[model samples]
Target: MAPKSDSAEAIVLNFVNEQNRPLNSQNVADSLQKFNLKKAGIQKALDNLADSGKISFKEYGKQKIYLARQDQFDIPNSEELNQMKEENAQVQQQLDEQKRAISEVEGEIKNLQSNLTLEQIRHKEAKLQKEVKEMEDKLVKLRKGVTLVRPEERKAIAEMYSEKLSQWRKRKRMFKDVWDAITENLPKDLKEFKEELGLEYDEDVGVSLQSFSGLLQHGKK
Candidate 1:
């Protein structure tokens, strides 16, 4: 009861444009079966549509997929196009904001995972506070000249100081003897030679052996 159609190419082109999606030769063939069109005829029609640039296609090995070309659609007016552009810009902005929010949430999650728990943090803070309080109290006592050293400790410190002073005196004498022996026959000026050799005695840098003796006497008071 239906009229016979002659143009397979026209039917295939119309079908592809109407679908507006990618369709392989077999898909077109199957869909056109109701029109009594063979696969080979559908394939040939699709190829013709592609060749004439009425539709776009991609080939995967022996198979071909056809899609309707966007350029084949009617152009929108300037006002409509501007409205579409504005809508696209708004969508893009929303997408960017969503991405930023997602990144921030991910960062926060990682930070929380890496950080110490509230109970552990409080415990560490309390320990540090106790240490700081102890140090501060000791510092205040020291500033007030409080005698923290025991009598036995003071005696031991004095003995150590005396032994160190004896060692210093012996080493200084030995150094003087060595210096006299080495420079006895040298013709260079003694001060210039000492300077050239980068040598410095105790008094050269504002330190005197006499100062240590004075300090030892002052500590007794």
Candidate 2:
């Protein structure tokens, strides 16, 4: 019987640690049953174990979800398992926060419904529905570990970057052409002078022709 009790405790610990997802009280009870452990024994063991930070027993209404404390749980060859468990904890926390917020908004919506006229109630309902949709979308993104950027928002941002890149490329091309045209119109005798100055005529004729022509035309000695 002692060995049996030890096996049950190990099973309970491993289940919560392994799943690492939230569940309500009934769900936890169901898991305990599946492990073939008596519900009362498992429940008692869980509660006591939780006090030592060995597990987390979160109560959502009558439902309880048990998660193994990352600090306490261990599995061999589980690389960065602790980090993964911590992330799961954060995700669970975020889910609870979102649920609370939705509940608050629902209460507000109910209050507004009671106070508003029929037409006003219709408007409020529409607004609330829109807000709920937005919140649901955000929740989906959170679950996926992605940030919710609306389609319109992303399109606007992409458009802005595209416009800037187009303009930048245009300016670069213009400057490249201008510089090429500059040396193109260098003085016919400039090559000899350049060679005399020991500055190799590596620029070749017609190099930077446009700017060189503009400079010569505007800056004649």
Candidate 3:
């Protein structure tokens, strides 16, 4: 009975196809040692592959040398090489355009930060954030066939950004709530206690009220 075509046969054939050179069963078995396949199993897979016409073999005395069929591979000619070069140039041009777009957005963000009103800044920030996300999606699509970044690395970066964005959003809501609570209950004589209350609150440090009079006395146990 012929040996069944299984993972062992597939692995052996893939290695043979990639090598494109005549390899003995021992050679294939050695190359696939990491798979922990037994020598007998490898020999059986090799025979199955040869029988299935997935590979060809030449008998050299007592041993058979196996190789993938040459016709299965497309050997690129000059015209094909030129077409690949043109495609590569077009991808590079697209990459350059993306970089320019990112730079323009960054510059606009900086300008808005320096000169825009608070409400305008928030509006523009939200718009720029959306634009940046769209640009990132485009970058991921463009990098599909290229080796600029590995898939794992891209995933890690995306996760990191998502985590940071979530934290920022949480803090923004917290700060807004705290500001509202402090403003609504402020004393009518705001100018007299303005310096004592230390009204300058930051998102990172939170609401810093140096002296809230008797408001915080209840929690002073």
What clash count goes with each model? 0, 22, 0
lDDT for each of the candidates?
Answer: 0.88, 0.69, 0.79
Instruction: Mark the 10 consecutive residues where model 1 has the least summed lDDT.
Output: 1-10
How do the residues 174-209 of candidate 1 rate in per-residue lDDT, one tens digit apiece?
999999999999999999999999999998889877
Q: Which candidate is the best by TM-score?
A: 1
Per-candidate TM-score against the hidden true structure: 0.43, 0.28, 0.35
User: In terms of lDDT, which candidate is stronger, 1 or 3?
Assistant: 1
Clashing pairs in 3: none
Where does candidate 1 stray beyond 4 Å? 1-80, 95-117, 125-148, 180-209
Cα lDDT tens digits, model 2, 1-221, are 12244576667766776777764445666867756767787777677667767677777787666776766546546667778888999999999999999999999999977886988879999999999999999889899989567778977866765565567557668866865686577775755755676653214644543453454346431
Against the true structure, whose lDDT is highest? Answer: 1
lDDT tens readout by residue for model 3, 1-221: 43345588877878898999979999998999998899999999889888888889989999999989999989899999999999999999999999999999999999977896988989999999999999998789787855667879977866765565567567768977876787688766654555567754443356423332223344331
Off by over 4 Å in 3: 1-6, 82-221
> What global local distance difference test value does model 3 have?
0.79
